[model samples]
Target: MKPARKLFLGARLRRLRRDLKLKQVDMAGKLGISASYLNHLERNQRPVTATVLLRLAETFDINVRQFAAEGGELAGPDQLSEIFSDALFADLDIGRQDILDLSDHSPGIAEAIGRLYTTLTETARRQSPSDTSDPRSLITPETWVRDHIQAHRNHFPALEEAAETVGGALANRLTMIDTLCHRLRDAFGVNVEIASSTDLGGATQAYDRSRRTLFLNALLRPENRAFGLAYQLSLLEFDAILTRMVQEAAPSDEGVARLLHMSLANYAAGAILMPYGRFLESAERHGYALDPLCGEYNVNVEQVAHRLTTMGRTGAEGVPFFMLRVDPAGNVSKRYAGESFPFSHYGGTCPRWLLHLAFQTPGKTITQLIETPDGERYFTFCRTIERPIRPTLTDDHLLAIGVGCHVRHASRLAYAEGLDLAKGMATPVGPACAICPRLDCAYRATPPAGHQLAIDETRKTISPYPFLAD
Candidate 1:
């Protein structure tokens, strides 16, 4: 029998050593190996022995399987190669050896190059009118926030409990605002002032800590002012808690981390404005109706819908729902999932989905029974909400907010009224045109990623690119 082939794991060994913040000599001493042998192993001149691998695992407190894995062992090199394959590098006659040599010897430079290309690609993709199916497209701070939200299943019981702890007539919307206003004045000796949008520079809320004043954009609809107040409260009252949450993320990008912190603070604001128990009870009583909930809570429809998804308190759970808000250009600004829906992390949603049509009937709730490529059925509803930057600004900020739940729970939704869901009368939709596999879809923007392009000169197919088998 042939002996097991020795593993040439140069990159992994180097990465492990660097991650431990140890020099070659220090790492070699810890592993009970000579520094010269370690250097040879790190340069792929010598194979990693089983004994050294065991020592590595024990010393680094890492799994042996990590070293056994081969795919990401040279991921920097592979990613650098992919970066070169972009149109920007099309004119250059770059070779495999050049890429490998640079990545292996100067991994820092290789990583920097890869990051530059990804940032440029992401910036271009973001400028496009449509949300992209590119996984890298969600590289924005919003995606990171979505990740943390999804990890918690769109619920933060701690935020809810914290809101409970900061109670001041929170059961009543008007009373809660009054109480928060009092707290703002009494606790911080700060006066809450509403100013014109121009004065506030289109910001929903801004705080002047030195002046001991909080400025809210007066252009915001009256229903939204409470949220602005709550947002400011989160920043002022629970800043340490908020900072702790952000620190837990330990994001490398300060800008992205700051944005994520703001997003989470907004969540805390919403959670406080609508304390969980009272809001949850009202939601169920109102059949999860956005308008009634909005009226009941004195908040906007977007706030009510957003708050509904955060109702995932264990044992006291609401109907599992997903919410998506897309701008007119098809950029998804907000996304939350209570169940596994076909939401693409990298790209725009299916054009055939009801939200695009909801734009036509602006300010009106539209409902439809939709099916994903995976045959999952949901009862979804959407309506457009205007978010004008200021009183003088144009109405380009219209965003369509959609919320849906499984067909099994559709009966509980007011939007699913009078729908014959049993007969399988669901309109098929998917994550995005680029990644969707349904061939008959007329609105597909691009060919599916996994399928090959079979452009027939002699014949024409219904779809633009005739999809061939993988």
Candidate 2:
């Protein structure tokens, strides 16, 4: 079935009526509709139908296509609404009507405001979490590191090539531990050993150059012990390559560039563990299943999740998944994407997103089909992964790792086995409720900025606030 051809001429219609110095009844009579119906049109309650559009253009002596051919082509209203939703403008009492007028007549100013709002948002994300509200902390190293990786879609070509070369050096090796230990000793003469957690001062992996040994957390499982070695190996053997990439990246912020040094090495570690070609093949054969791939590759769940998001290699791309890791408090720690999605970069992801709930069922993978307010759909899966401090210690880091791709590729995933793509709620979600355009969601945290607020003493709805007559 064909979608409806809807139009939004409310702002323009009202402007035309006012310019002609005519009242609602006069315009309604001219257009052959009830005055209430004309009121609805002026309020954007209904799309301007072709018949009404023809009447409007003829009555106003204007080009019919001006009001019909590209109806809704200008979406300044939606963008401006997003801009005003920022906490910076939260105090202002701007209404939907004002937004519409601004976009309808002064679109340039509205767009400039929107751009400024976007810049503010990007900068805010860089601020240290401890001093997020301080304004000055808005330029932090973590932000730059994240932005740099995001720009590259978390795939560094030079690092990947270096990692492949490193992998090729031990093509016939069996165990990662034995292979990496031999390479480290033979190439750099650095010994690898798994030490008691306290010996490494509780660090997952530590290097002691004076002793010529790399100490890993004794509590780590065999796979993690190997990963610890792999991480050190990348820094040890590919130091020059990683350093060159960091230098070439050369962020204006010294702190950011310094942070990328570590980020690049970590990227190399993941690449080396799951060499691009073999990992891509395993991912495809396993339906990109996290656990199975984790087992086959001898890595942890988070490692597999992180690696899956980096399959954006040219001429050999895999499904573009957007991966995000969050703590119990909903603080996003790491986010990597091989494609764009509607989640917020600076604010809390929608509480309604299942990734948040994944914590409740630790170690269990939850599959979901999500549809954002904009109508984009995704096939997403998430599970909780625990990083223990030691073998017998109670202290651990519980994080939820989520990975998803656009829904068109749903069939390719094992998680999508029983999903009814055609007839499910599809979990209407968005970046965050403040700027989200979904009017019907009961989970909205705040009302969208553009709409007028109404207090109806006689009626109540499921959500705390109900929008007045739209």
Candidate 3:
């Protein structure tokens, strides 16, 4: 038999101690170990024993699996690998092991590098107007909120509990839209009214906080009407929870804090609409099929898709899925994840990914098996969805929702039917044309940034942009 792997979690231990603001002696005493022993453990001079690991978990109320993992932070390893893969660092010739070691030992540094990369990429996109970047100022409020949500794996227990309470109170109600409206009026004294689109000044929904009234555009569908009512109810009913979450996030500015608050409120609304216990049961019973869940919960497919990304409750967790919604112009409007999707931080996504093709066949579900450049395969499904109508605004709104999980979880999904999953062919895709490392993609729209182009004056290759192999 092979030897058991030794657990040397020095960096994680040290980081934990620092985070808890405990000195080595204090931590050692709490762990029932000598300070010298703790020091040795922190230096990786000795492997952590099972007893010590258990003690650490008990003392800190943290999962020991985090200590065992190479990187304590969930997003660290992948972000580090992605950052180091840039051609700017190509000359360094860093390998996967080195990246893992850095992520393991110096996670704070790794996080700092990730932040720098985000800023750099955001800045670059700003210089090239044609490139896709947040239209807001350089603060990147959306990026901050996205990172915050990903850090928590898109689940918030407090919000879930509040939503469950609301849902239970309204469980016996037959008409959800009417139920939501009645609850809003009875609980918060806020009257819900459908108003002409011209009166709302082109907004889909507007709330008069002082007057305690909500105005929803007449053009909104029944699903959107219910959503608007639920969103308003969440804001009024769970303001404290939402505020606490935003404060805990410690966003860079007030704008980002407000955005985070709005996002949490949206999560609360979804949870309230589809309570955790009932939704998870229906999802599993239907093999996680999108349409059945939509019909069961009286929600739209986009709502169901977004809800799937938030099914990361501790004990009753569902499949860890990542979701993205993009318009025909390739603008990603909504992205949430219980799993990392390796989304591009700078420019547009890979054109070859089936998500782009979803616009062609509206209202039809299409599934594909795709492999990233790193050889990680996933099973994904995409379908077109229309945004909620705003009669006063321009009417060209259409979007595609793409949801996927790792290939290991494919067998559990209804969309993965009839495929030889073990040996099935997967279309190879990468992050974005600007950063993708795929050297021979025929559909590459732009050359890989920061790499020397492999120019051939004599002959032409299938790929439009060829770069030197490092």
List the candidate numbers ranked by TM-score, top first. 3, 2, 1
Better of 1 and 2 by TM-score: 2
TM-score preference between candidates 1 and 3, better one? 3
RMSD of each: 10.1, 13.6, 4.7
lDDT of 2 by residue, 77-108 (tens): 55566567766666787776788666655544
Query: Candidate 1: deviation at residue 428, Å?
Result: 0.9
> Judged by lDDT against the true structure, how good is candidate 3?
0.81
Global lDDT scores for all candidate models: 0.73, 0.74, 0.81
lDDT of 1 by residue, 317-432 (tens): 78878899998888888888765565665567887788888888988998888987657688888999878344554547678998998898888877766778767588988765
Candidate 1 accuracy as TM-score: 0.70
Error of 1 at 446 (Å): 1.2
Candidate 3 per-residue lDDT over residues 1-470, each given as its tens digit = 65766676776788789868999999999999999999988886788899998898788776554346443354355566667667788788676568667665555667677777877777675765442344334537888898778766688888998899898779543599889988989888999889988899878899998889999999899998899889999999998889888887777767778888999998999999999988899899898999988888889999999999998775577888889888889888887777666776545677878897888898899999999886789899999998899453576678998999889888989888889776899999988776677889999987765567988989899998888865
Using TM-score, give the best candidate's number.
3
Candidate 2 scores a C-alpha RMSD against the true structure in Å of: 13.6
Name the candidate, 2 or 3, with the larger TM-score value: 3
